[model samples]
Target chain A: MTAPSQSPIYDRVALIGLGLIASSMGHAMKKWGLARSVAGHARTAETRAAALELGFCDEVFETAAEAAKGADLVVLAVPVGNMGALAEEIAPVLKPGATVTDVGSVKQAVIEAVAPHIPNGVNFIPGHPLAGTEHSGPRSGFATLFANRWVLLIPGEAAPDAVAKLRAYWEAMGAFVEEMDAAHHDLVLAVTSHTPHLIAYTMVGVADHLRRVTESEVIKYSAAGFRDFTRIAASDPTMWRDVFLTNREATLDILGRFTEELFMLQRAIRMGDGDMLHDYFTRTRAIRRGIIEAGQDTAAPDFGRSVTGAGE
Target chain B: MTAPSQSPIYDRVALIGLGLIASSMGHAMKKWGLARSVAGHARTAETRAAALELGFCDEVFETAAEAAKGADLVVLAVPVGNMGALAEEIAPVLKPGATVTDVGSVKQAVIEAVAPHIPNGVNFIPGHPLAGTEHSGPRSGFATLFANRWVLLIPGEAAPDAVAKLRAYWEAMGAFVEEMDAAHHDLVLAVTSHTPHLIAYTMVGVADHLRRVTESEVIKYSAAGFRDFTRIAASDPTMWRDVFLTNREATLDILGRFTEELFMLQRAIRMGDGDMLHDYFTRTRAIRRGIIEAGQDTAAPDFGRSVTGAGE
Candidate 1:
């Protein structure tokens, strides 16, 4: 399995919606020779043209149905809200015995929307890659986007062989693959991704609403801390909107907990409880150390922002 | 004023609390010949030894009073809560014409705490350099830490010549200097720094409290979004604790607004209001663009984290 000459995992793979994740998958698959042919589709002619020009895929189609034709694997990589319609469009053209999966952030919603459209003998495995940049479009992707990142698979009742093949494919692409149930995957992601994004978005909004501080001042002085929130909030708005809508319960639950914790900290600040604030801050520091130890992020200061000269 | 051979801004400089900011000041002063001699003192012997060994100061003193002796400029780089005590310690030994300033995050508290200790002829200017990293201590200091970052000066009743000299010193060190009243500086920082750090700390705490997700799992999947929070939360706990405690009213006020905005977003999510989320996310994206345009941060994806091999 580790040999360079290993056969391609799929004879043909189709990526529907040539955005960041899809384009990144195309690059990773091509770099590792994980698929014999990679095909892509997007709603706009410009995106399809850009994908072909960027060599993200061997062929580009204007419609999802056309892209799925003759492919052994089909990846739905659009926003979560569009997953159901795209699944329905490609259901008729999906090849027998083909395996279909998605790279949506919310697993339960994707499973609920796309599972019903899977044809008999076709595998429907829902997956979410726990990685992304605060960028979008075909040009934003690179082969290393998935390197050392987690790609969670929610196979439900998919055949064992099909699940194994998909796991091997993700492994080849440099992602660590694990199987998880849909609901658990959604909840975990809420705590890790969705709620954080929402908080970042809300903070940026709050900063903008403060009339006393000019926007120029906010931008000029952002290096202190607010710049990180801007980076997270800059992520593709459409993708995040769909994530919140589809993962409503889990995201809300996590957000509720976050507000409660924030309120406690606020009370401590109001009461001038320095000891409590110090203890809370110290405890949070350990979590950051754990992330660094796990190799998920670097120990480099400022997320290595200074190296780019943009930080200066 | 821009000539390279201009006389040193101060004949002798004393830095109280030889941590990241003071050590960086020492390095910057040496790099640009901004000061004739640099002396430092820290509460911990280990820190003072490290500062001397790292060549961060020309001399290390046993006490704040000893360090301030014969110094033309004395900078209080200690935690906000320690400013008053250190000021009292160094007041008797301060040179008659010395200019005393601080690099505390909260300006009003520093002014209030240290103002009474200033000698008859000494200038007291409370300043806050809006620059830092998650890492702390003498080892984390670097000359370029303040490059292109803001250093806000709350001069209050300080002489104009004194403020100009300090501004020139910081400009030589590559920081842009801006003057603001102490109260306004505290409020602005609360919006841009203190509250953001608090929110990040709270988010990380919430993730840690989630019993359903193991800490290992949270760490493993942190790249999704939570990793940024971890970085912000990892900032020096003592410094942050002091910031919240010292700037209680402004920090709590900002936190109140943040909670209100967060609640609105949370309600939208709970109600499955995708339109509200999409609009809010869109508005936040504009603020990010503003930050990038102002050169406060980079447009590079992931804060340029991907440039380092750790991102892969």
Candidate 2:
């Protein structure tokens, strides 16, 4: 069911990490009145102070347990590696019948790590918003971050009513919600996100290590194609490290397939096989058109001019 | 030295392929009076008609040789694969004392292919404007395309005066001009553009072939990282195919190094080497910052939002 036009989804919502996703959620909640009061907690005092200054929350807590004490909704918006430990720390203080969800990239590992510690009577759901900028920290978020973007919910054994309420809250906060199985979600994301991100990181790393091409030259001429990889590689390092660790199997599998495909293309290039390269390049072009038609991305060339003010 | 404020650098200029680069040059030349008259030619009648309709040229010719006739400067703006044939066709008509240059992606191959056919007294200078949008065709160009971008000139044996005049013309159109050797230019481009494009094409191809993850699912959830690859993969098939074929040695060499680096990352992932992954990702982020500081790209987190209207 859709959320009501002007009602708060929860009396108190606790954001356990004051990063991009958490802060965006707070802003969205405030903009849509999805929660009556927002509470935030981060390990760093500076982040907690910054969260309070940003005015996305009514109260800021120094500890995850303190944030979860009286909240009806607690969002574990931390890196995947920290989820288990945080779950254990907050387990004793979680309000009875409250819904606890997460915004971790990897699901199965998070569920296994956080599920046992999510005390009885609390609903534990794993979620991931398929939206982000190549930015992190409290200041890097906006209310519209999740607008028209997917927010997948892995309900596990959580109650239907809790799941429905959570879905309504996300929809009110501008996300299009979908129900998904945890394993399948991991595999799909590995193909769409994890493997691609690793590849971007690798390519950028390669450019960095090339001694012959001066770093200045690489950066100056990046608009040709490598700049896009740089953009993706610029994402938060901690979050990505945890992603590869937790989503190990799926990421490795997709990467294996990718290396195989790359070898084929490499062989074609070495042999000067114009027809094969042309055919492969031509095929990929159609997929790009499909993405445009599907409204996932724009048809604009995005030569990094508008983004960087380069051609001005 | 810069050309005088109101004087045209050339009495007549011919662009022998009215595609993105040629059309953009026409616009820039017209904007600044860089040339007194511009004539264009394209293989397709439709492109020639469209070029004439766009009014970027004083006249449009049906053949490359006709376009070259009597022009003081002629630009072979055709694909790398066609440079030899186009050069042969236009050689007989090329004016004496004319400077003939090209905007090919692979410089050495183009120099080898187009150099032999140049008539005596005609200057054959191979050049590449390190700027473009993913969009192709004569209609996809704008006057500001070359602004603040690098235009590398490889003057094999062209006269110094002719090279200086051509450099001034490019500067007049707002490009930072540099002189470089052809083989080196090709190697630099392989690292910066060609290999990155091939990797993008390969990644997109991998996603397309995944049966479990429907094409629509990949398109829907592309923002995680795959969308960037899609944008690069969307580049013109014919142009990219020619680039890989013509820049075979350098492309293969870089691709070899890329695979080796990728294998190391892959091994680190499989071994759950968080330290290694973190270190590598951290280094790449610095290069991205360098690119921003160098005025090559922006630190704007270009979430593909403003360009695509996706998040809006």
CAPRI classification of candidate 1: medium
Question: What TM-score would chain A of each candidate receive against the reference chain A?
Answer: 0.91, 0.92
* Recovered share of real interface contacts in candidate 1: 0.78
Regions more than 4 Å wrong, model 1: A1-7, A296-312, B1-7, B296-312
Number of the top-ranking candidate, with lDDT as the measure: 2
Q: Please report the candidate that would top DockQ against the real structure.
A: 1
lDDT digits (tens) for residues A145-189 of candidate 2: 776677899998899999999998888866678888999999999
Model 1 residue pairs with clashes: none
Residue lDDT tens for model 1, A252-299: 788889878888888888888889999998999988877776563543
Candidate 1 lDDT by residue in tens digits, B1-312: 123326688899999898888898998888778899999998888998998899879999888899999999999999999999989989998888789999999988888888998889999988888777777899888887676667888878878898899998888787778999988888888888888888889999999999999887787677677777787888888988898889999988888898889889888888888899899999999888777765635532222222211100
TM-score, cand. 1: 0.92
Error of 1 at A243 (Å): 0.9
Displacement of the residue A118 alpha carbon in candidate 1, Å: 1.2
